[model samples]
Target: MIPSYLKDIGKEIHSNKESTKLKIICTCGCDEFKLFRKKKSREYIKLEKEYEEQFIKEFGRGFEMQSDLNGQVFVIKRNIFGKIVKKTEIKKLDIPLFKNFISVKCSSCCREYILFDENIHGYDAVIEKNQESTIVESKHYSDDSQKIEVIVYYNDDNEEENINDLSVAFGRIKIIKITNNKKITYCDFECE
Candidate 1:
């Protein structure tokens, strides 16, 4: 069950017009979802302070810096001279990203989904009945601003499938050839 405070925050996130434009439906055919957004609220600030205090209590020293990398938390213990004394990697911290993003879970199926990510150029998901799978595709921009497409396959049961089972190849444009005066386009991608 979601807490009432979190539900209030979800309502605040849903009030954004741009966020509402992106629709993500669950495989169970339910469009309702619980939204969560990272924002700077009084509660958020309190949570951060509490975490820092807890870290100091456990480590017996105040951490100079804290970071979350690849779902792992790391705290840097610095000496009074501002030199790094020790760097310790700890368990995952529940701190959210400072950037703009919207996370959601299906109300009916409880399937987790990302509605929007600031780093991603585009995000979408759709169910392919013929293939008996749900196709999720996200577009990302490289350092040079080149568009890259990332695709994830999920079965009808809402479980993620292995990437090796994918039948279609991605990250390439369709090749067109003329055979006997007939145009033939190879490498057709349904989720363009």
Candidate 2:
């Protein structure tokens, strides 16, 4: 008869599988949401590369998307030799039913909106701080499968400024932008 310890080990293995539940991977045209597979770990990178290759072999090419900052819906086009073959717009609302998305908060007002999910996990900026003026342009993803940008202006007359993600209610961002335009513009994500 199998020993009790061996039986316990088997049970543990079974439970481990159950605990690490594998959901149906989200996709559009075979390889949507591929970036989600990437993590800041070597192991994850290797595994993702393997998965990507396997997917390419099985499902063919993936979509190349282009969208504006804070705009929902992405344009997917398949190009050969840099010529557009076919193009279509995929809206965030069009994400398949199986996957889940979270609602994001406005970075400025800290108010909430039920319009979309928080697929964009981080913010980035393009900033230029010179003796004349300080201009910043922050970018982020939206639940609408769109990349959005925001502009922040600071007074160069001040000794210095620290408008980091940690300093503002926006928290941490994945990207930021800085522009030299004197006329300041606001982030479109800000609610009225």
Candidate 3:
């Protein structure tokens, strides 16, 4: 069972200002999390690169994660000579690389955690309510054959900026992954 501290208020990932709508209660029962923003700011860029490395290591050799035009993940396969052979996109989180992810330290454990789905290799997002992420698009490089996945919500908000703006308004978000095979797990409060 999911602990009471980790219940989802169900707000979608709509904005940066109302992060609490996600209602991420620290396991330590304290409210002293350091929220990180999504942007090219010095801190965010540095953190993003590190986060990228972590994903690469987690996904391993046969699978690689790269960003598509929408800033989501695309996987690629490499041959023995490290030559690119195939690339595929993932139908997962919108901000592929921990965009709105934050680092929070539990007052009780003093352990910092980054919310992540151990199975999905991503976060639990309220993407269903996103007004700006409606599209079904894919890209293919002229060389080195590959395929990708698209998880389009088909909303009217085609504008990323407009969607970002809506994020600040309202939504419910959660951090759990379940499969039809009956696999279910709460997102890991990864200690950093």
Off by over 4 Å in 2: 1-62, 67-74, 94-192
Top model number, lDDT: 1
Model 3, 90-162: lDDT tens digits are 7854344433332334434555444432222212233333223212132121221111111111223333533
Scored by TM-score, the top model is 1
Candidates 1 and 3 compared: the better one by TM-score is 1
The positional error of residue 192 in candidate 3, measured at the CA in angstroms, is 28
Please provide, for model 1 over 1-192, each residue's C-alpha lDDT reduced to its tens digit, 9 standing for 90 to 100. Answer: 111213222222122211121123456666555544445569888988898788777566644547665566666766679777778887656996333444556656766654333333111212222222322343221121111111222123222533322322121122222334454542222332
Question: All models: lDDT?
Answer: 0.39, 0.28, 0.37
Q: How accurate is candidate 3 locally (lDDT)?
A: 0.37
Task: Kindly list the per-residue Cα lDDT of model 2 for residues 34-105, writing each as its tens digit.
Answer: 111111347656766776686466435765666668764554545567775655565444222111122223
**Model 3 has how many clashing residue pairs?**
13
- Candidate 3 has a TM-score of 0.22
* All models, RMSD in angstroms: 18.7, 24.3, 19.4
Better of 1 and 3 by lDDT: 1
